[model samples]
Target: MHCQPDYKHEVYIWLKSNQMCLLCDEATHSAATLCNTCEIDLPWLTDGCEVCALPLPISGLVCGQCQRSPPAFRQVVAPWTYGFPLDSLISRFKHQGRWPLGQMLASLLRQCLQDRFDNAELARPDRLLPVPMAAKRLRQRGYNQAAMLARWLSRDLDLPLDEHLLLRPHDTVAQQQLDAKQRQRNLLKAFALAPGAQVQGQHLALVDDVLTTGATAHSMARLLMQAGARQVDVYCLARTPKPGT
Candidate 1:
């Protein structure tokens, strides 16, 4: 079931009280409008493999790379291909210090969830977990984009958002520079459950802004299942389609 935005008058009041710029504030602008600079300069994933969400030929459902070796996550859904205006929007939300875009992006992600659940034989997760960031990154960024998205999604989906259930234990090299195997290895042991965390018999949905290599989501999902989650689903605002397609 999908809920329309209420656009509470308090939303604007809260924005003003927080001294946040609805369009330019560091937290949510990516949710409102993309800045001119980032709108033109950001890198985008134009074409990608369907299974892994890596750029690929548009003709096949699963690319050769995924056929040879599959990822751990069961399925993935993204609203837009990671390209152009969308890429710029993400870059600003991620790198340019705009955090509010997280909310806007979450709105988009909510729509994707509604569509997928409406059209497919998918199970709705009981909980939503954001792909966590390392302590250092969290401090530097002042917020986790995934967590921000998860918070809003929780409101939209009426599911509890468990922010502390999972955490990134160690910082790893950027996955963008790694190959499939290297990407998996780099993220290995990078995430772990928080002390005394419990997810027994629950369904979990992992949220992230972008699905690049599926390495990070795979690692996180494994941990969630180890903690007793019965099922896991992956959600992102954009998927980097394989290179050619």
Candidate 2:
């Protein structure tokens, strides 16, 4: 599910400026590595279900699935659909340890959140929580991509990052290729709240690389709400479209 990145492509993200675009190799006259043209061409999610961020034909409409059974999270805020160079970049950052790419994406995501905040379209969460990865997978990958993103977002957004507030003690069968129902079943008991976590009445955001089926986010949000959290929202790099849509 991951790859080894070419060493030549790696860069010390913060220490570098006037960077080359990761996708096009154009000189980006900014601290961010992505060039403006490539950023414009990325798969921006202009319209989606307000609650789930499931790709929809219009911007503010709730999908039938959310209407039938509302998810625990209040909203899913993602800036892009899972497609194209964005997907490839995420794969490299997530699976191949290309952290500079991850940082670039997180910076863009921060911009999205900031715009929403300025327009009163989103409420700032009390805490940012990365989706807890299973220990086995964490060991194999040498990092949790979600946590890395959360760290960067926390720094940029001046939000609290709780890396240990949630725990994923064990691994499950891969959720890829599984339908929504099966994915939910696979994630049952996949997460736990850490001892003494003070989640009560706290608005929290779950950070992850991508939102696919919404199964994982739903499960985790339900867990937090059951434990007395006030609200939950999802913050991720991209959202996959509904199947066949």
For candidate 1, the TM-score is 0.75
Best by lDDT: 2
What's model 2's overall lDDT?
Answer: 0.89
- Tell me the tens digit of each residue's lDDT in model 2 across 60-178: 79999999999999999999999998999999988878778888899999999999999998999999999988888877777888988998899999999999999998799878868
Error of 2 at 52 (Å): 0.5
lDDT of 1 at 107: 68
Model 1 lDDT tens row, 143-222: 67777678788898888889888888898887889887899889878998888888899888888888876888888887
Among all windows of 10 consecutive residues in model 1, the one with the lowest summed lDDT is 1-10
Regions of candidate 2 where Cα sits further than 4 Å from its true position: 1-15
